[model samples]
Target chain A: MWRRRQDPDRAAPEAALGAILAAVLAILALIGPAPAWAAETAAAKEPAGAAPAEPMHVIVGYLGQEEVPRQPLSFLEPELQDEGVQGARLGIADTNTTGRFLNQRFDLVEAVIPRNTDPAVAIAAQMQALADKGVRLLVADLPAERLVQALDQPAAGGMLVLNARAPDDNLRNEACRPNLLHTIPSRRMLADALAQYLVWKRWTRWMLVAGRYPEDLAYAEALRRAARKFGAKIVEQKSWTFEEGNRRADSGHTTVQSLVPTMTQGADHDVLVVADERDIFGEYLPFRTAEPRLVAGTQGLVPTNWSRVHEQWGATQLHSRFEKLAGRWMTPRDHAAWVAVRAVGEAATRTRSADPEQLSRFITGPDFTLAAFKGQALSFRPWDGQLRQPVLLAGPRMLVSVSPQDGFLHRVTTLDTLGDDQSDSRCTRQ
Target chain B: MGRMRAGLAVALGVLTILPGGGAAAYSVYVSNERSNTVAVVDPETLTVSKTIPVGRRPRGITFSHDYKHLYVCVGDDDRVDVIDTASGTVVDSLPSGPDPELFVLHPQKPVLYIANEDDNMVTVVDTQTRRVLGEIQVGVEPEGMGISPDGTVLVNTSETTNMAHFIDTTSLQITDNVLVDSRPRVAQFTPDGRHVWVSSEIGGTVSVIDMQTRQVVHKIGFEVRGVPKEAIQAVGIELTADGSTAFVALGPSNRVAEVDQKTYAVRRYHLVGQRVWNLALSPDGKRLYTTNGVSNDVSVIDVAAGKVIKSLPVGDSPWGVAVKP
Candidate 1:
């Protein structure tokens, strides 16, 4: 049997000693010229005083909508219940854990709009309400345009807004806001990560297939830029016009098997790269491609922020903890939201300040670094406030690789090799 | 200087008296995290002497105060496996709370402080009775454990919390918390007890905190030419007896940075195996052993030579290393 220490009285003397030392240092500072170390020691001892100060309150608003529509794919792709919110919830829990030690308190005010409602009006109203409630740190899970609208709202003025869902390149470029920090990796970054890996493997020739959606075209455009940057060749390109039918129907498999081969028939390339951000037809081309080639991009071997199969760098513990909490594997949105909130926790703990402006300054300063279970410390690019992280190349069941591959060099960091660097930045904000 | 000389003299006397102890006969015990085994390597021959099987996911290893038993944190088993050094077999086990990752023993007392990573607590156990004494609530995901030279303070670095919690030994309560860079993985007290060096694996820097003020006086970062900044992740730290030179294992970069303690400057980078996680210095302070996780090898570094002398193949994903005193 273990004897547990139940008496809190044992801590009283230590606290009392701390208080006395603080008082002595305070007196020494007031009386005569004290050494620099004395002032520093006094500041360090403030947290140990007998009477614990009131915990500094930091309220963050989770602004988003529930039940967003998904692509009509396999029945195995279940509707996500707590996609972005659960990540913020876990982030709050993580923040509270560190907050407890720092005499700080973190609270999340959720303002989720209904799926059927007008998102812009509902989001604006929620932002106003959150501002009324003194919520200054906001995690926006809205689309790129709606996120921009929310950022432009007067209620969001002076607030630090973290974009957790939007991965639009314009968010980190020409339309980037001074107060908004982007946690999601842009399409360009994802494309570059995949391109680097493919180039490293010498799979330089690509047969590009794109879905007939604006998002899909944008992703294809990014991939095209990456191919040009990394010296890869796009041997052929084609757009898919076939509408996705009921994926679970009996004839669905046969239809996909016949349609994909016809769509990929004219291409002779090393790899078949599909750009289908909506997941409409990318999964169909993997095993049914014409040339029996390796498939990559938005489906087959995809680039993502977080994967259920990633269990390296102590991510196994995080994965298991999330499973225990949410009863499911963590998604990329969850990881982004978690990173956003954890950034707040880290800044507050380091600066020992709860002021929103001070926190924002500290977060953007050179000292800010966040550990998001990615094996490396992640920091925001000062120019665009985009979190720089390694993109994971994952297959269906395993992590294929992490890119910014071995030889991809950058003056700042290898991570810069993935995203927009200082030289390429359209963001004018310092 | 006199105290250090006396300590060296005592170490020499122990080496002469102990059966397995000698200047050139020290053994290095490395825990292979993924393989669930401990590889025992002889320093003189630079070869693995024996492979001892242990529980699942064994990490963070150290020797008992009397040097009679080796304590290994079998993380998946949620207990500490005590191995008798003479037989190189498990003799007993201690209740080390849930998900024990790393631990430290009080220099003069029989108390063992174990960092329970998942439970967010440090379990203190009595080695003589194999019974837990008390549990101290700490930051989340605590991994690193370091004790002051006098055993008055115990430092535990929480991975996710990113702070080093300093616990008073007598009160068993947190006395101070120093925020380091992100994902602090290991902490070590300088031999002179003036500072505590903490390595932040994700932040890619080592924070040297002043012991008296409990403040980070210097944040030492590495810059290996041609190696990306993110790859220079400082994880394991080993300080010399004189506290003049420090060696830091840069994870994933496959290099160990030798730093000057006083100036906090990296003097040289020695190429090692992939993903070097932990390091151990010999009792005589002549050789350093590094456990490289990805390459599955132990890099033997000659301290005076400031370079890797040899790489000995070990089990898969070798993580923590402990040297026989």
Candidate 2:
């Protein structure tokens, strides 16, 4: 079932827009020589003067392209069926809360493409259908390549799509699209955030351990770039191969305990950075390291856009709200989707318009900022359309630190130093 | 017991005034969020006279009409602990809705309006009867309660909703809603009740709304020379009684901005301890006390000189401050 609900009782007040005095006069004139209770009931039923304003409807579509469900190594983590869409639903609810007072209502239309289908064709069809329904705002929870294909669709040309899933660097760098704005932080941004924290703590030497997956290699490359940008040195590097075994079966720790330490034995470094983006061996490398070095990068002490351990700067308020709605802790993807939908809502509220062009222009232009419990105002970067925000460095049970650390300065904002700055960006969008 | 505590406080005040010391006319109470205690400080001695333990995660604090009881919003416990001001101890608990963050007492009545952040509603309670009056549905994360000087209109700013809701006190109905910047933390009315200044923390701006029209008339922004714009978050706002000057606490910027009320210009920035959260001014309007959240201390300011005179250490993470005159 869809999460959209229409409240019939939320009619716009007749006395809105400085018409209280006129409404009072009209009420008195309508119920002349009537009993007080009758007068009160008549006034409560409907104002006697002006017709009530019709609430404006702003509809946003959510397009989720199917992918293979990821299986976690441990049983504690399960595959989430509705990660991004739940966040969009919460976003709609939050926006409707504010929209009720402004005589505006928000609705979210969700559609998911089945797995093993031609994603390009599915994306185009979804876009055409959504556009036919007058949904000019969309949240795309697709891969980097499919996202580009979706934007290239004729129907999507007139729509504004917020990228809530993919975080590939090239999508933001050389292959940027004009209609796409990213809410998820890029891999390079996460690497830079972690590197800054490690460098600030004087942990300059790192042992880079990468996985065989393409995403893992991409993340490893980002870590290398971050090390070069900051002052950290990669003392050694290793590539891990898949070992077929049930990680949660009986006596599973014995296998991982021996393999991880042997794999980490040859490095002389202050920290071990794992590039296992998939639910792989990264979670097993923390306490099983040869040296007692802290594990970071994709697991252990990791840099993330959102975490359950974060509670400062009114984060508990958002965490509780999301938990109440979704019945689970808010994930990074959920937060990404939430911010994407909220960005559209915030733009509509501030600009007081439902037109996609005007809202998109205001969002990309100067003077547009959104606050999503990050302790700072977030805005889209001019060059790449990447969001500028602080990344949380979190352990499993506690928030260790926040990046864009102290002493890291920039000409404009310290947040710009984490992601690709405009000067070094290769994006052609203006 | 009340007379005994007052006598002891007077005797200690006399002892503290032996060496060119002027006895303070008020006592300062600060809620420590991390320590779950309220630190009571003597303004004259510039030291904590006593520390009273309360419920977990004490944040918003206020006083009763007669100043006989102090109410602390124990957020984690979902209740308000009432501290007997005379004894400097918690005496009772008021049944509040879920996660009450901030609240305001009616100026001339026994009604207390509490913002239930978790429930997205405002819980109205009669302090004298200790009974629930009504619950008004509000925006998301309702915070920053402010009442007009005449006590006819109440303004509650919801942080996530990004709107300042104006409620009619008599009918308990929302009259008007004014959209503001993001994460509005505090709302303070002018002395003459002509305007309400709402501080938006993440938006880093203060919006001044005309009370009559319920529209934003002017917006005030803050900028520190070396500090980044994101760090200059506006949280607590204190306006002078004469309505000429306003002091705003800049969270994490470690500075308090002094604004010219008439022109809406930031005149100067006063550097204080780390993460200055909430502020309270003395009754005579001469001294200002700031609760530094990160530094676990309170910075005392000389309003005339516009400089920090002293910083007295307190419990961990002092959140809200109130002065009893």
Candidate 3:
């Protein structure tokens, strides 16, 4: 019954320490004292048939979401796979209960399309087969385009798709579709979150370092939009090219310091930002630079989906519980996956049925609110159908700051204001 | 200002430490798994009095016989922090075996037995001098350990071993080992000493051990995915003084179950919060509190009503719940 209030007034602490403490207390309050209103609502609404059976039935279908791993020479590292299918499996246990409430039973059965498979055709076949088997909710971790294609098919049937990936801003804007509830926050929102923190720290002037990779450049473009949208100024812009395994003196480090001369030349400005999504040179810019700069993005002050070590705000407990259940630390996308299932649970609690129309209505209703494990209340944008959330701006070891930093103070802060909120949406599906 | 902070910490220490000497009031303290502090609260007043810092990763808690000291199980630190009742400072530490969790102190004896969750053993310590008495190997993942009223018997619950280990305190040996349930934790003996109650968190069942026969005579089951249920993973366990009722905390299901001790059947299931770990009941047995680790609050359940009346907020990652002296 403990529910996150959609109150716009809730905020982070004065500084870093204060932020952690407040987040812990705020999250504790949400999980601790669930008002009778939520319990009464769940009891009054959930379909009696959702309750557990002896055998414990659950149905799970994969959206075949990964971008084909591109060159197949991807690192056999833990974090990559850690973020994908492995994280999606948690939806099984999560689909049964939302926020520790287990009114429903999950009998999980998986329908997966192998990598390199066409999600449009393959997912449609899987969705049809699953729908006939009484599975009403689909956890679609696919890209924005594949998601639309998968949803458009009459063969795909009328199942509500729980969006788990594709963090593009356009998806929740002009591309927003009905019955598609995203768990991924758009890059615009995430950048704005980072921008809010910088502005709050009075680091108004920024030096931008763009990565050579295409995706990195796109992220840099988002940062540019965010910088201009906020009051901050990007004083200088520079680009860094990566030669694999090269750590040259004139690599990213010199290029970043070279920009510092012009960006802060005889002028007072804080923060040096880097946009390196390819994971090549971003890890080297911090502390290696000449000045004592507060580096951000793929470097000193990067924003991540989630970190295993962030326990300051009761996140350790969340990590431990997830590790205890899944036998591993939680990843970034798992947050999205967990949110998807939790949204389904919330919708199920409200509508009392797994029926597609009723559940989708319950989820998309203006009054609908979901807890996204980030100590915040999460809801969908009617425009491109992206999930609106505050991104966790993190460093390698400690949290630099949370985005949507204090003092930007809109009804929902400039963080929510940046992404597609209720005011700026085009599709209006919500 | 620093002096005042220290004075307040001292006064708070005295209030929570001293037995009937401090005040005629009730408060709750919970140990967080992640944070290095204990959340203190005045339960009756419903206020968070203070969050006193402590050693690393504290989990279980128990008070001294005369309530002169409060012992906290700091699992990662590998020691039990003893808080002096008068000063409210961690005066000393007891050497508990590795990864100590969940404690049960003998009322009269100077002995404190701890279930070492990781080392798969029970650490018996002398509370008077704050020293390790000896260690006794029991089962894998020893979680909950409790001593009998007579101070002669100690029961340890093993999570993966699926057994309740009975130890002879005088001899410091595991005299009898009887199998129970999967993930057996939080073992306690009946008040009158007729039977012992063991809760299998993941097993979702409570096994009753007959004291005389030394066997699991009765098995208490839960209707809601009892131990075998994929969703409901139970952890915390406690029993009333009269031995007529018991309570079990379920983690993911976020519910507390009331079991009729006589019939070994669940009478009620009250929803609470996620990842609940430890349990504590008032000496009068009217109110029960459980530490919800994930939710970061203590579930204050009205035992008679079989409902969670309120939840008391605590520090980050609250995992162990204990009542102040």
Please provide TM-scores, in order, for all candidate models, with all chains considered together.
0.89, 0.90, 0.56
What is each predicted model's overall lDDT from 0 to 1?
0.82, 0.83, 0.63
Ranking by TM-score: 2, 1, 3
Model 2 bad stretches (over 4 Å): A1-51, B1-23
Off by over 4 Å in 1: A1-46, A69-72, B1-24, B262-266
Off by over 4 Å in 3: A1-58, A66-79, A94-103, A107-134, A155-157, A212-214, A240-269, A287-292, A321-329, A345-358, A366-372, A381-385, A412-418, B1-55, B59-69, B73-325
What's the best-to-worst order under lDDT? 2, 1, 3
- By TM-score, the best candidate is 2
**lDDT of candidate 2 vs native?**
0.83
Taking every candidate in turn, the Cα RMSD to the unseen true structure, in Å, is 10.2, 10.9, 13.6
Assess each model's interface with DockQ, reporting 2 decimals per model: 0.23, 0.23, 0.05
Candidate 1 chain A worst ten-residue window by lDDT:
A11-20
Residue lDDT tens for model 2, A165-246: 8989998988886667789999999999999989889999999999998899999999999998888999999998967565
What CAPRI-style quality would you assign to candidate 1? acceptable
**Per-residue lDDT of candidate 2, residues B154-230 (tens digit):** 99999988888889898888887777888999999988899999999998889898887677888898877667778
**Per-residue C-alpha lDDT of model 3 across residues B1-325, encoded as one tens digit per residue:** 0011111122121223335544434556677767878777665455567776778888788778777778899977888988775566788888888777788887578888888775657888887776788887665557778778788888887654456777888888766666554456678787778888887664556777887767667767665522213235556777777667777787656788888877877788877777677777765566678888878888777666667767867777788776764
lDDT per residue as tens, model 3, A144-252: 6677777777744455677777776666667755556678666667677777678767788887777787667767888888787777898777777534553433355
